[model samples]
Target: MAFFPVFWRILAALITSLLIFHRFSSAQSWDPGYTFMHQATTAPTVAFYDYIIVGGGTAGCPLAATLSQNSSVLLLERGGSPYGNANITDLAAFGAALSDLSPTSPSQRFVSEDGVVSARARVLGGGSCLNAGFYSRAGHDYVRLAGWDARLVNESYQWVEKVVAFQPPLKQWQSAVRDGLVEAGIRPYNGFTYDHLYGTKVGGTIFDRNGHRHTAADLLRYAKPSGLTVLLHAPVHQILFTSRGGTRPKAHGVIFTDANGLSHRAYLKRGSNNEVIVSSGALGSPQLLMMSGIGPIEQLQAHNITVVLDQPMVGLGMSDNPMNAVFVPSPQPVEVSLIQVVGITHNGTYIEAASGENFAGGARTQDYGMFSPRIGQLSTLPPKQRTQEAIDKAVEDMKALPQSAFVGGFILEKIMGPVSTGHLELTSRNPNDNPSVTFNYFKDPRDLQRCVDGIKIIENVIESKAFSSFRFDSLSIVTLLNMTASSPINLLPKHANASRSLEQFCKDTVMTIWHFHGGCQIARVVDRDYKVIGIDSLRVIDGSTFRNSPGTNPQATVMMLGRYMGVKLMRERHATNGPK
Candidate 1:
């Protein structure tokens, strides 16, 4: 009897392991049928759909997928597909896409009017393809502020998680960072979770155990192939409107250009419920609207774009979270890793870190975007290349070094709910050109104070006992702030008083965490349901609708919003026209 029990136990364990392996393998190979996907050059000159979504990005992909279940959808992406793009799918080659500034690359470079370098996603998966892969849901207060239905929000988050989110395995550097955050008094340690909690915790990631990233585009696997059509490299020029002697303008179609520079038009099917949704990112949404003659009268006319509606608030209220970091060099090589651990403080400061030799791989030497501009004389590069250099330079320099001169990792701090705001305006009439936007980082005194407070916490972390081994020397806060070898960019003064130096540091070293949001904000550009206030059958449902960026990373909530809004639109249709 004892022998039989042992044999059964062994058999059960083997079966469970095999089942788990099978599940992951299936997920790895699963494919959404590609029959309906096409290059814009191959698309017909005219197409009609129940809904037309411009920008196949973080929110657009999922929204299109969800809507495809019950209606015909056209998803237009200005960039190429993410499928098989190793720079995007491989976690080790993380910043590769951002560094590739070619016209066809998946990341588009932009320089904010505040003089900060930044890039936006030009791929089907959007920022999900370019971010650090951290995945955490929005805070409870954020959900309430957005006026989202709690139950539906939870359901939508789960739907996205099942296909994309995963528990990140924390290696040595990340584990040490987590301990340091705790030792510095961030809070109780909450192990692996997706919830946005105020403490040092390991958050979910889109990267799998094998280090492959599953992006929002993966959600398309749930889409109905027959009902969805995704066009790659299709840049929408403007939304087309027809005036039937109505009080408000009605959007019925959009004119876009194909990869071959040929024009094409996509229209919504004739139905009271049909709509044109703009799921382009924060910058793109407002720019698209203005390009279509729906913005401030002076700005539109300045660009030679005809004015459709003088919506004065179209390009107002833009903001980006400012980030600062300290580099702790190690005597020994550390394992490569992206963001896995984070410390969320009560005052809305976020602490995170990443380490690995691959992160400092030699291939990125010329990538000004990922490294310090001082490293390769990148500051002297032409304006075009300089614009591509958006992320903080230390990290970028690390990736460029074949053999890193500084074998270490960075512990960074980013302030939340930034009070300072700016706006975006078209620089040219061409839809493909980058816009002139200013986040006006640290313009608000309160936001500057938050940065100072966050830096103090980081200083504590660097001095903590848990982080001692990673420090090659006794580097002071001021010295650490000036650690990077070269740069025309300003650094903290070595002898200034702590108070003055810290505040100045906040202004001088303020780099974007790439979490910019708000332009076409809710109540300003769109209604609660995301419908454009003065435009019938037109909506904007991306991060542009957020007054503040949600969660530590916005991808999860952005993706969830896609599904949530898709379901809401579906239910409304069902109630009005009956279920299909």
Candidate 2:
């Protein structure tokens, strides 16, 4: 009996082994969906490589992709591969898992001296991998007003669209607010055109086809080349510059720390005039520069670190889109919200929308906005003018509403507006230390006014005829009704008051959408070419380099800047060396 049992066990074990092998072999051939190929063998330690791009993110990925086709290139990322986590491949899973996996603890979040937390992303694909996939181009007018050559900007935008494969959502949900805006006499504009200037109007949103989010990682996957090497979980500590010709300082290599907290130095290949491109996103690029002794002289001196470059602008000009959300009860108690994305340019329109069915692949129909000088010039206006314009528009639209009509639509009023300037500062000498970020949100008087303005606009929209069908009641009314019915008022707080204005509701409930940018701004840290003023072979090509945050989501603009910088670097290298 014992011998027979042993024989059966052996047969079972063999069958299990064969089954496992078969499954494993099948998985190898099945598409993994997203690909992350890391080179196993380290490159030769000699200073080599035609280009060294840092961050492997929204910007760095494309930059390395474009440059590596014809040259030896090195791409370094501070986090592990995007595919390192299976959850990352699923859009909903990524969103659900992000909160837990985020590096900063809830207690250690970057708080300004005034006590406000600024959310930042630290991962292989950086913000692009984690962002809410809203792809918008830089308004042509905005780019032109930033003093970029029109021809160059146009070319760059085209290249970016081509490489990134921007797509719009297949189905769109029309918000009750859209009808309200039109009824309130606000002109309706197609929000996401390549040639249009995006306005304050609320009618543009796009999503991918599979109902999965389309991030920059998707675009970059296609651009990956064989020679390009991506190093994950490697955080660059500092750039080591080798002085050439006694006066000219050139970059030779970078020293970085791996995930295990061990340090390693990567040198440029021999005889290769390598350039280090930093696309570490808005928060990271500035942090890296400050750590490498390239920021404000006083701050560096305070840290007992030698200032390699006394660029005070390294952390200045910090800006981000102050976002707020309004949650309205669905009129029909729907399971999902359809998002329609639009950009209102002066001369063009861009529109994208997505329904639950196609959320994975993103929006199906995409329209590109054209270059327009008027829209971009808005940033150049005096701060007072900008504030007044935003406020007046809101007020004018609101004043036209009748009180009785406003209470009829989906009534949860969430307003996001009134952006505030912020700064990114190093809290410690350690590269791993989170920076002290101060948004000073709503600190500026103008920002407060803008928030108020946004609330008023919402109120006006609620009063319009388009919303009358939904039957949106005030919070007090809903609460009273619930109380009378002996039902739990779950959505309302116990401290709620009947006298609160919609504006007050907005103030108490709004939160940041996490679109930080504009610190380490262009023309401040670097010139038109994105090269740091005093450093050679070093440049910043990420959201941090924006002179001003465009009104739309910044992913497309960030990618465009990366492509632009990459092409320029390649062009310069070719011109100087007469083509590889």
Candidate 3:
């Protein structure tokens, strides 16, 4: 065979192998003897099971897999299957779709409503299959403070690491910004490793295998259990519950509509005592709950949604990490594309992990070293109170370090930006209606100030002699000030501007990086066990339950929560009765 043909054949085989691996890895139980019978002659009636899990995405998949080990599990997903779809499993193809596909396209969007768009994946594996795999555990102190039992959370983290099979990228590429850090004197600092914090002047590492991205689908699909039944293309409209006389309400089943728009009800077997766990992510879980009368009374009433439980906190405490892209001219072209420089707490990660304790008790524990001390300090402040002074100090600290010897070949520049706080709200009562997601990016005055501080620090670093050999653009503070003034009230303090002249030069250059989270916050709607407050047999195990947004990619934390919650559910069930 010709060399080109040989290479093509090898590539094709590798892709096929990866797809097969992903499928088998996510399959927890697959019983050849078990079969789903559809009554063709009659209207689809409620079918019973021991557990009903909504949203077969990242968290839901793991939860279903874990629960199905000993119980009859029904995994309901609103979107269609992702397996065997070239558009989904193919990374290059998926990236293209991200740019051109319609916002309503299930394979492309997070949430789209009222002209506002957020990143959401409606396919079988949810965001896990789509996200850039960067796995890091939630801060230890934050987890401890979140009122999560320390032992349980740690065990869950360990189990998650095993299940996800997280592996850091072998090749680390440095960007112009990272070079600017070296010139500015920033050195690579290897902080606590177990906490998954590796502070280098460059970007945070990725989780890839042999140059290909690994996803949650790769993990759960292979371990699919025979006892577990996954129903794809079935969107859950509402959770069905039953009242057991004066006691708390118990979720008994779910009402879902299939892709063909036919409604069906799945009931729990009598005396089997099933529970309904909602892991539809931050956007979907809260939205579904509110539609079923489980949210704020006023909001539900305004939408004419019948109030079921009057849970005021169903959709409250919406939060997310605001991200802005900074472009810098590189002295040389680079190979690595995505890099995360800083992962700050700013109340979101800490509050969610700590469970709403005071900052001292929440993030001030031993695991604090896992994060940038400067970023950690900023996280200590209320989002509104973070000032330029604090941001400047953190930047100064970063500038004082030396560049990594491993990444010395590239000419680096810096891209300093802001992290925004946002929330999600329902636009209509319809299940198909996408919710209104107001990221409120850069709305807070302090958030803007931090970006300015970050930019200034980057400029100082670039001016250092370490980077004198390389040629790059100098982003000035004046440009930040001017851009802040010229931008819209909601999108001001644009991070892309490198100079005051640049800000003036391109007044319409602001854009969003799209990292939204924290709508159905934890502790308020759901307890530490992930069980919905005041509702029995109902739990939420996804990013939506984050008490606050974690400052970095939320995939790892979401998976950890799923593992933790799944184990907790199993343990509790086992305590009451002998193991299955």
Candidate 4:
């Protein structure tokens, strides 16, 4: 065999072996480190805890850990542990986890009325366990706007970072994407920092170098085992409350069902400070609250459910941060990624990318082709001329190329701050039913304009002279969206600037980052301190309480808020207790 052929085979075998190693290695469970993870089947029907926390999810996990340091905390999760679920703990299992529709799989799948497909975690660690594992500290504006103490927020980040976040390694495609981002006018690159800055920068991730995922549940390692008891697969049916002489209703306890469908009652330890906190997500949190009679009184009565608090905003103002993406195919396999490279723009948009993600279908590296040809020099003429040349080249290349090997890369854009908001309300009083969520996206004409701007940005990034050098203009998102056109890449010049066509495309194809928030907002549903406004002994600590969608991935922000809430609750508990 020729020397180059030998080298190619060796490289292929090595890559294959490494991929196999990663798959098996990530298939294993992460040690929960705490010995107290229990199932509802074995737990007691009646339990008492100084603090009863509901929903052991992203926020719930850390909150329980922080609170158990000072109080006997009972953490209840409606799903199983992240451990032993390879899909939840493995980076190679990324797409599989999101697409999982198994009854017991951590991901709970759903589709909206708009025909968009998405899923939420039904597992212990919640979204962190199911999401792409991109970790960026919440934008500073979010903390300030939410009235959170910046000092405490920073401190809380450290509390969670020490357990879950990791600095990711930069490789081929991601590095190329970074260069493309810088070329697209995203600005001065900040190298490998987790801070949310406006520029092209490599940030933190939850996947370690070995492709193992360290989720929020891992933070349970910090839990005081004796003080914290986490019951898995234990879904809370409703918040149990009691009234006091014409005053606001107080959350005293909860009635939840176990994995075996057996119901149990868990109560607060009976101090003025003891409380039940709901850390379920936007949908789950609002759904749970409404089920407990804390929603619009009229809506509850219409459903024939008792109204406890009559708070209209309980399931209002839902924002899921609608997004659109541009995918480019590589000529060879690229390392997988979540969101290592981030481009924060001054415009109301955030551009991020993954090295190995493409939702568009086209000629991939792995596809079969018949012939391979060598073409002459291509031009840098004006877009129309250049696009025609590129389209011709793409057609010629596809027609002649032999069996290929390539990966896909994505340039994703999320609307930074959408004014268009939607809502999530219960489909029924049944706790088992998923709520009806409508993310009334692109309703605002301005939002549509911003999305149009976003598409132009992606087109610019793909068409940049810098990108042209690498043939990055070859198979771009524009070409993919131009699936019906005569020529894919050639159609770019026509559709990229056609704001109306692109806006219509966005309206037709827009999907969410699934960063659902509100439906239980801070000002309208919960107080500044995260306490339910008219209800005592309860708090909403998850994404449900966010005032508005943060610019970036809200996971880090959500976890930070969880820690901050724990610190606040602890201080209040101490104050309620007076002197030591």
Alpha carbon lDDT of residue 146, candidate 3?
A: 72
What total of clashing residue pairs does each candidate reach? 13, 69, 51, 4
Query: Model 3: per-residue lDDT, tens digit, 1-580?
Result: 1212232222111111111111223322212232331221222556777888888787887777777767787888776555555434443232322322343344444332222233567766787655544455656666766777878777766666664543333222333344445444444443323363423322222233432444444445434366677776677788877776678777888888765668889887765346888888767889999887788788889989876688877765555443332222223322333333432322221100000001212222111111112222111222233355763453343333222100112111112222445555678866666677665544565555544444444445445554344323343334323322332212222344435543222222223333455656667888766778898878888888775544245676676666677777777778876777
**Which regions of candidate 4 are displaced past 4 Å?**
1-27, 357-406, 469-478, 484-500, 578-580
Q: What local lDDT does model 1 show for residue 227?
A: 91
Off by over 4 Å in 2: 1-36, 39-47, 84-86, 102-118, 149-152, 162-175, 191-207, 222-224, 244-248, 269-273, 342-419, 468-471, 474-510
Clashing pairs in 4: 365-404, 365-405, 365-406, 371-400
Candidate 2 lDDT, 1-580, residue by residue in tens: 2212332222111111110100111121112243334522343334356677778777787777677756777778766555434333333332323333246311112434433233455555566655445555666667777676668667776776653333543221344445555554445544435443435233222233443434455455555466666776677888877765766566777887665566767767655446777888777789888888888888888887767778888887665444332223212222132334332322221122122211113231101000001111111122224254553443233223222211111222211222457677887777667777666655665555555555445445545566554433543333322221221111222234421543344333333445667666777888777787878878788878776565456667666666776777777677777767
Best lDDT goes to which candidate? 1
Any idea what lDDT model 4 has? 0.71
TM-score of each: 0.88, 0.72, 0.70, 0.84
The residue-by-residue lDDT of candidate 4 on 57-156, one tens digit each, is: 8899889988898899999898888787776677765545554445787777665544455577888888888676788887787777878799999999
Task: Report how far off residue 580 is in candidate 4 (Å).
Answer: 7.1
